[model samples]
Target: MNLTSVDELFETDASREDKQREKVLDIPLSKISDFPNHPFKVKADEAMLEMADSVKQYGILVPGLVRTKADGGYEMVAGHRRKKASEIAGKESMPCIVRELNDDEAIVAMVDSNLQRESILPSEKALAYKMKLEAMKRQAGRPSKEDNYSQLGNNFSTKTSSDELAVQTGESKNQIFRYIRLTELIPPILEMVDEKQIAFNPAVEISYLTENEQTELLETMKQEENTPSLSQAQRLKKFSQEGRLSTDVIYSILTEEKPNQKEKFNIRRDRIDQYFPKNYNEKQKEDLIVQLLESWYKKRQREQER
Candidate 1:
């Protein structure tokens, strides 16, 4: 009978559970590097502090996933947050599940794991989707459309990668494409989208502008203290495509008052209270005022007709 070592037996058992053949290994924190272009942020916020406390009290309950690098170090595949927390907890080494994965496979796994987080920024999703889409296309051995997007013209029909991405991510095909469109936006504009300062539809339209045009638009927005409406953004995109967009043109479009952009009127509560009942609430006072205005307008119209 052949005697198997305990480590070997554990490895054999772990391999049987997964087709990928993952093995838990204690890796030094210094040897593990971050995944290139990892879209998810690892902030040392309250949650991270809590996780660090947990790690200090009980060690890392879950093992991180990592792959061997060409230079002999390990690249983190998942659990970046866990790694950071472990470092904070004064841990020299962390338990990791080692796996061999190619670039496309790693990208897919990394994206899938991070997407499960509760909160993801818009810019993070945009860049992550773009990376995964490119990886998927590469894996399929299909040439990317980005290299000759303008040369292929607007009538091209290559959405296989996007469709696959949509299926994987639970987003609509059109929405996936829209998020990918955000990759063309400059960082400042993209950050605005993440901050909710810019709406999604308008941001998509703005992404079509050339870099110079986008810079000018950013300046115009800052000067005017306003963001583009969907219609205005579309007009800017159309003008850019036509090669007629300029700083002056952007200024003109931005200066145009939108139909819904009405000036607000404010009234002091103390000033209006004398005109209403002492017991009347704010809503009652507003309704009574509106009724009186309607009656006054009707009386004036009747007099004018007489």
Candidate 2:
């Protein structure tokens, strides 16, 4: 990983002092404003509330980045969520760290900061990974014929650059590919994956399903009234291979609205036991045996259905 593309990698030839000055700093949030052109932040109502709650207790732990505005003020380069949360917390101003980031550095720094936090969600992580790849792309430009988005799938985007980036970053090509696959997952499904309700491999497999098919599966999960289980996913895959799996069929699998339990009691005592050896009567034994037989019959029927 010769990330040290020499000149390309550094963007500037500077000493330790310059690097130290470029490190994240804490400035008043009031000094920073939104980037009208920034594309990394997703507008998530739930996420906004989550961020607000985090700020209310801990305060802004990681300072935001800002570039000097043309209007003689600071405009946010990253940490929009933090900035928004500061407003929600009723703070008169928030802390910021100032910097001059060329487009690639700003994008990478923004993502790098968020990625360091312990509590980012799966969707957010997906976006973070995408941002990194794109930023790296911008810095390195596109690869040669290897840049096909299809054959490489998540393994490489704009194929021209993944191997080089992986070498530079010391991240494996496989991991990069997996992170990329996560982007294909729809929002609700991604939420499930984030929440740990869905395992990764199955989630990846589910992601392979068309977007419409994934939507259908989500609806089925609601109706079937059960969380999507590992077994159910395998069954869905089987049907998909058979070409009979549809949103409707998946819904039926989920709802599985059939009778749950029907039990019966039984006995296999010797015929001589009917005598009860004393006061037990013929009618009592006869009734007990009949009940036992009915229970056994029902059990057999249930077994046959399975």
- Misplaced by over 4 Å in model 2 are 1-62, 68-75, 81-85, 143-160, 164-171, 227-244, 248-306
C-alpha TM-scores of all predictions? 0.74, 0.56
lDDT of 1 by residue, 40-122 (tens): 88989999999999999999988999989998999999999999999999999999999889989999889889898899998
Q: Note the Cα lDDT for every prediction shown.
A: 0.86, 0.67
Among all windows of 10 consecutive residues in model 2, the one with the lowest summed lDDT is: 143-152
lDDT of 2 by residue, 29-102 (tens): 66776665453454548878898888888888877777777667777877787788878877766667778777
Best by TM-score: 1
Deviation from native of the Cα of residue 92 in model 1, angstroms: 2.1
Lowest-scoring 10 consecutive residues by lDDT in candidate 1? 147-156
Candidate 2, residue 269: how far the Cα is off, in Å: 43
